[model samples]
Target chain A: MTQPTAAVLLIGDELLSGRTRDINLQQIAQYLEPIGIPVRECRTVPDIEEEIVAAVNALRAKYTYVFTTGGIGPTHDDITADAIAAAFGTGISEHPEVLAEMAERYKAMNTDFTPARRRMARIPHGAKIVKNPVSGAPGFQMENVFTMAGVPQIARAMLEDIGPRLEGGARVHKVQLRGPGLREGDLAEPLGAIAKAYPDVSIGSYPWYLGTGDNGVALVARSTDTVRLETVRGELEALMRGLGVEPIPDPL
Target chain B: MTQPTAAVLLIGDELLSGRTRDINLQQIAQYLEPIGIPVRECRTVPDIEEEIVAAVNALRAKYTYVFTTGGIGPTHDDITADAIAAAFGTGISEHPEVLAEMAERYKAMNTDFTPARRRMARIPHGAKIVKNPVSGAPGFQMENVFTMAGVPQIARAMLEDIGPRLEGGARVHKVQLRGPGLREGDLAEPLGAIAKAYPDVSIGSYPWYLGTGDNGVALVARSTDTVRLETVRGELEALMRGLGVEPIPDPL
Candidate 1:
């Protein structure tokens, strides 16, 4: 069976403005990878309604699952829920369960459950809540799209709640081989040949900076078939030796 | 004048696989912000050819500039350059100058300039080379799309070369106000009213976790008009105070 593919839609002007560096994509990707749902694409857009609607529609249609982060708070800028509703052509209303949860949490703190705070209870029609352990507000899942918090901690908690429900496909296996003190040009020919030979395995070369004025490249081979992956890795090590460089098991 | 918008397309499977966390989007966004070109969107796609071509076409058409990083290497997975050519329906060939530069660098290092390394010399028709100072392989510009290396250091170096030539637009002015120990629900009503009152200024609220079991929210206002931005900021501070929370000038 084909591995289930996923896409991540990160929403917020803060992300696009460089005010906030997104940690959610990597977190979500790592979380989904073990479950055999590899995130094939990720798009970060500003807090615009039309953009969010368009991205949601496009990604949801293409991938098996679409996860969105940010814009579910009480502020006016938190329009992700609304946009998701618009994308699905559904109406949003305050969910009673979520409202009750937030109300109890706020009541305990002696805080008035204001309209803005109550806004967190608003979810798209027919969506199921993705529980948040870190924050009081709950994320929601509309169809295959999972809308979670932008905060890294909260997004992680939501993922934990959502992970078990997913139907995972084949788990991918990976092998890493590092070539220190080697120019990419030197290894290019053999690496390309190996990639061509092992069509089943996806081979990638990444150059790293050691902060000591020296650089190195790491060769990564990924495939679902363990035998093909190992064969490609062995060839990669031999190629590194051919260039008079020893292949290290890891970069560090 | 409206600020010129740009989009960053990060192409690599390593990024999607969570093998590498992307630092390029923030770097590019920060660099462009100062020059009056704001990055409005960023999309990360795997090393697949069809994905690359589709992203390049979509982003380049939507924004004033589209900056792409990764897949310009010599490996078989490095199909970004070829995909870019196909996106524009143009042919690619090894540019003489780029080939000469790579040949000189390899000769100096006593390395054989293999076909894989020489592949970096290929450029799409009518494209200009964006010089790479760190590595010898030069990135290229096919119209508004600037293709650079996947490596952070090299991508940064290529941006330095491309920064000066860009036609920047109006610089955006910004003001930030922080409200510590304030629930977003409490601040939501006044904040939304303020946002509605000042349509020109874009207001954003970001929640922060202090690692001490306490949360804070930062309010940011951005506009082209400095006076309006400050006026909105002042109102935001007043709104925070009205909600019994003191507004800090900045987060730090």
Candidate 2:
């Protein structure tokens, strides 16, 4: 099977405006990696209908799965559900099940179920419900696209429900090696040789600096083959020893 | 004149694999926000040539400016330069100025200038230098695209040189209001009314949760018009007070 890949569509003006730092991309990527469905691409777009629709369509067509977060709230600016519906050319309306459940919850809390709150019941036609235990506003699964809340904690909670729906591939393994006195320039030659020798593995050279000068280099090798990952780790350690820069235990 | 907008392309396999959390997007967005060139869209793709080339072309064509971070280091995985050249359909070669400077620096540090180290000197044809004070391997500026180092500090430093090169539009103003016991369900009606009243302004409602339940709602209104921004702020505060929920001083 061709390895299953995923794409994330982050819809919100807050993310693009620099007012809020996005923690969702990393959270989603991390959550998916262990499931053997790596996130290949991620896009953050403002809360505009055309842009959201275009992005949703583009990403849904390409990846095995597409996840969108944000703009699915009880406000005028929360246009994600409508945008998703437009992208798939499907009709959207309030679901009786969700509306009844939400209304009961509000009544239990002694709060009136206003029309704005009722807006949360809107769901695209033919879409499956992605349950929201944290809040009453449920996200929908339209085909391969999984829509969730923008709030980090709620988005995170939604993943528990989503995890079972995915079909994961062979697990990808990663090994990290760090050198205190080493830099990218110092390790580039030998690391390139190792990388060339092992064509199946993906190696990355990351150098950390203290603004003034270099602090160290973090070398990470990733592959689905566990044996090759371990072998690459040995080679990485040997290369660091050859350079006279003892490998640090952890540099993160 | 139409407002100038920016798009950020973050390239790295580490980010896709969830090995590293990206900070460049927020950094670039915050930097450009004050300059009046708001970041409209942002995409993150792994360190692959064709993907990089495609993203570069798509973003460069759509936005006023394109900023890319990552895959510029001296390693086997660093193919951003080649990908950028392919996108622009230009030849890339080692620049004498960059080569000489890097060689001198390596020599002073008592390091050998290997072929891998020499790889850092390559630059695309007709591209101007984006000075990297942190490292000797300077990034390049091709047409409207500004390429910079993947390292956070280096990317931050490169912004100082880039700020003067951009032509910014009218500065956007923002006002934020936080309600302690208020929820989206409480404020949605009035907030929607306000958003409709002020078509030129963009209003956003963000609800923070503590996993179990809602903590509060952060209502933000943004516009280029300062007077409208203040009016929205007042309206937002009144909306919170009308529900008998006191507005919080800070909720970020």
Off by over 4 Å in 2: A210-214, A248-252, B210-214, B246-252
Model 2 earns a TM-score of: 0.96
For candidate 2, lDDT tens digit of each residue in B15-82?
Answer: 87777888899899989988789999999999889999999999999999999999888889999999
Place model 2 in a CAPRI quality band: medium
**Which candidate ranks first by TM-score, i.e. highest?**
1
Model 2 per-residue lDDT tens digits across residues A1-252: 678999999999988887778888889998998889999999999999999999999999999999999999998889999999999999999998999999999999898898998988999999999888887789889999999999887888899899999999888888878887687777898899999999999888887766555578889888999999889989999999999988865633
I-RMSD for candidate 1? 1.9
DockQ-based class of model 1: medium
Which residue pairs clash in candidate 2?
none
DockQ for all candidate structures vs. native: 0.69, 0.68
